[model samples]
Target: MRILGLDVGDKRIGIAISDPMGWTAQGIETLKRQSKEKDLARLVELIHTYEVDTIVCGLPRNMNGTYGPKAEETRRFGDKLQEHFQIPLIYWDERLTTVSAQKTLLQGDVSRAKRKEVVDKIAAVFILQNYLDARAKS
Candidate 1:
């Protein structure tokens, strides 16, 4: 079964997809948020296009491990997505995922402008990959 991963942000939503066998995660595309209706519609289209069975949403938490307003917003988004798509949704702790992505891009000598373009999507890939790896080991 294929799983979709989302890094939800205020202006953009990064997307990632797991392999059919659920072994690995790959960065897909970034969804530019226009409106809730449009964003959800686009997400539904992606779900259908990729034949996604499950969705993994990144939940931002404070360093002290508390859910903040952003996490609450993410939960609401996930709820809406589940209601619309009728797909299973899981929340993954996304602490420092963006930081990790940034560091990775820096190591690869990616320019700041380019990193801004792909950081969220790369973070989504990291989130999904971590989930896939954990599932494989279990």
Candidate 2:
């Protein structure tokens, strides 16, 4: 019951994976975007390694909960993943998740330079953990 979490952005994609029992999520790495084929190939390697059964993608929305162009782009990428992997994929509202990650890093006293390196991966962890928590609640 492993699940993969993604915080996809224009320049990079953060990656997280749940435990085999679907208990917790941990940031694995951040993939620097390249050509589409390269990016997908990299994702394929992670998916295979993790034996992911599902994908939880973060969908960035406006403050008022409106879907913006960014949201549509995310949906398209997620659709590509779902179709290619033949696995179920769901979107979790990602409003402020990156901000939350940044705050957490600040509180932890991580340097700004270091934070920039890992913020997206941490954001992926937050997104995945939130989804897991919601599933547990319901």
Candidate 3:
């Protein structure tokens, strides 16, 4: 079974998917958030399309390992997603995932504008890859 990953933000939601063997993750797309209903609808569609058995959502945490407002919102989102999707949802610590994505993009000399457009999806990939790697090692 495949797994899906999400990097939820205020204006956009980044999507990623694991290979059937759960070996790797690749960026799918970035969804522009419209409303809660629309977001959930799109997510359901993606879950069905990918035949996802599990969902891993990025949970932003402060450097000191504390939950902030954004983290709280992420938890709420996960709760809503679990209620609607009725699938196992896991939250992975996503501290600095975005920063890592940005650094990778900069090192690759990606255009600033293009980086902005794809950063969320790349971050999602990193988040998912981390989860997959951890699972593999365990």
Candidate 4:
């Protein structure tokens, strides 16, 4: 199944999509947050465009594995996604994906400004790729 992954943030929402065979993930877009209605509408368009069957949303957990306000907000966003698409929504642990993305960009010598713009999308790719790898192993 083609799966869509999301890394939600206050200012932007990073998006990724798995290949049809679910073997690879590609960074899709970084959506700037506007209104909830607009955001959901844009997501719906992506769902239809990609023919996604499942949504993998990142659940930001504290390093101690406790859900805090950020996780709660992510859950709420997932709820909205489910209500709109009525698809399977999987909450995957997103512990250090952002940090990892940043490190990768730094290693590649990406400019700080460029990293700031695309970090979220790269993080989303990491989130989806990790999930796909785990699924393949299992």
Tens digits of per-residue lDDT for model 4, 1-138: 689999999999999999999999999999999999999999999999999999999999999999999999999999989998999999999999999999999999999999999899999999999999999999
What tens digits encode model 3's per-residue C-alpha lDDT throughout 1-138? 899999999999989999999999999998989999999999999999999999999999999999999999999999999999889999999999999999999999999998888899999999999999999999
Per-residue CA lDDT of candidate 1, range 1-138, in tens? 689999999989989999899999999988878999999888888888989999999999999999899999999999999898888999998999999999999999999998998999999999999888888899
Please report, in order, the local distance difference test score of every candidate based on alpha carbons. 0.92, 0.94, 0.95, 0.95
Q: Which residue ranges in model 1 land beyond 4 Å of their true spot?
A: none
TM-score for every candidate vs. truth? Answer: 0.97, 0.97, 0.97, 0.98
Listed per model in order, the count of residue pairs whose N, CA or C atoms clash below 3 Å is: 0, 0, 0, 0
Model 4 residue runs over 4 Å out of place are none
What RMSD does model 1 have? 0.8
Q: What's the CA error at residue 8 for candidate 1, in Å? A: 0.5
Candidate 3 has an lDDT of: 0.95
Q: Candidate 3: deviation at residue 76, Å?
A: 0.6
Worst 10 residues of 1 by lDDT: 40-49
lDDT of 1 at 80: 91
Residue-level error in angstroms, candidate 2, position 130: 0.4
Q: What's the lDDT for candidate 4? A: 0.95
